[model samples]
Target: MTAPPDRRIAAHRPDLADRRLEGLVAAGQFVEGERWRIALASVPLRAAPRPDLPFETEALRGEVVRVFEETIEGWAWGQIETDGYVGYFSADALGPLAPEPTHRVIVPRTFLYPAPDLRRPPREALSLGATLALGEAVETRGTLYRMTADGAAAVVDRHVAPLDAPHADDWVAVAEGFLGAPYLWGGRTSLGLDCSALVQLSLAACGIAAPRDSDLQESAVGRPAEGPPRRGDLVFWPGHVGLVAADETLLHASGFQMQVVREPLAGAIARIGAPRSIRRL
Candidate 1:
């Protein structure tokens, strides 16, 4: 038998084992009433898995938040309080993280199955965590979300948690509603999604059609404008992108330093970031 190729976050960070103090960092508020947190140790995914697409990494010694709904074990996207670099992690093998409302974390284990009706008794199968929203939303009916090893994923009767980030949830809702997920690289489903795909999908939810990918996103979304950005605007970086951060910052799951992050518009503009754009959709 052939051995599976080593596709791990360490591939992105060859120096992940080293415990080092890099610099002063802090988490930014996405929602208006969000509480902030100061990371002590690295809170990486127990395993490495893709959130939207394959990830790339660089050398670093710090922590990361594994997006279970988006990635696999042994894989994680590296993240600092500031930069969200793309990388991997050993799922369920990192320090403990305080899963709070302000900070939405996916369950590392889940399951999915094709069921005709959610009201029907669930099959004698358990799905581990894989996909995570603020909480899973109930689908129309007779839909299989997916499966892992613990819980089952179904669009049926699931309920969404009280999301503090209304805008964020709204983005998710609008995106999922349009896409109806589980979409592949080009697959459009309310269950699956990608980064740019999410953007385009969200816009579509709001009745705005956009082309796929970053370059296309700039052209299809809102037009070029000079000045501080506001809510519902899309922020773009070179080969990367994110949503506006409350008129002053930009929030995104940047592949640069993987993980959902926020940064100031000026700070983003001054850097090697791309032409920041906005989408009124």
Candidate 2:
């Protein structure tokens, strides 16, 4: 018999499945999902279609999602194209796919302005790694801004870089920037994030693709290392992961402290137990 699908990334349920899996999986119906782009700064992808449910991950602005189902209650069952994580997302957070992204936010966080001027009320706050489709540049006073393709908002020019720009050389330094950020169960934004998200986001800024969860990350991110952990090395536990910031320090979004923090490696091991493996990126 064939092995069962990994539901975390599988676009399947007892009632339906993506048409692409027609022969590989069994379901009551198969669909050719419609593509939709995330229009909000960030939207939660939950395991269920209820507000009370905690999200499994977050879909960033401009990311495409292939929607397999929609409900009148304002939920959509979809798979995030970037990470291939399937879940329920708010229908309102999605929009038509058009004017494809041209730039990506490179900073930890930035605000979207209704106008180019800083004095104007902000429209939304976007997090690192979010993509945007920008039009021509505009200047208000001494600051330069890029207008959104739809002209709905503007972003500071320095906050974003061309989508094709080179990645940062030090992803560990990128992760350090999130020190003190709140630990969130499924969040992937700078405002709040989980352990895996911290790893994924940091690597993404360095143009490296990583899986969305700790297990997948531990298996896919890097080759196994046999010696003492060094800076940029990823340390994995049973269900958690962190980066070795130095010979004796660990950096991670710690649920114990409820925030991202750096602490002595020995202390962390004492609290969380010894790491299962170390992977050098």
TM-scores of the candidates in the order shown: 0.36, 0.98
**How well does model 1 score by local distance difference test?**
0.38
Per-residue lDDT of 1-281 in model 2, one digit per residue for the tens?
A: 99757888889998999998888888999999999999999999999898999979999999999999999999999999998999998899998899899999999999999989899989899999999999989998989999998898999999999998887889889999999999999999988999999999999999999999999999999999868888999999998999999767999999999999999989999999988999998
Which residue window of length 10 is worst by lDDT in model 1?
A: 25-34
Error of 1 at 65 (Å): 34
TM-score of decoy 2: 0.98
Clashing pairs for model 2 are none
Best by lDDT: 2
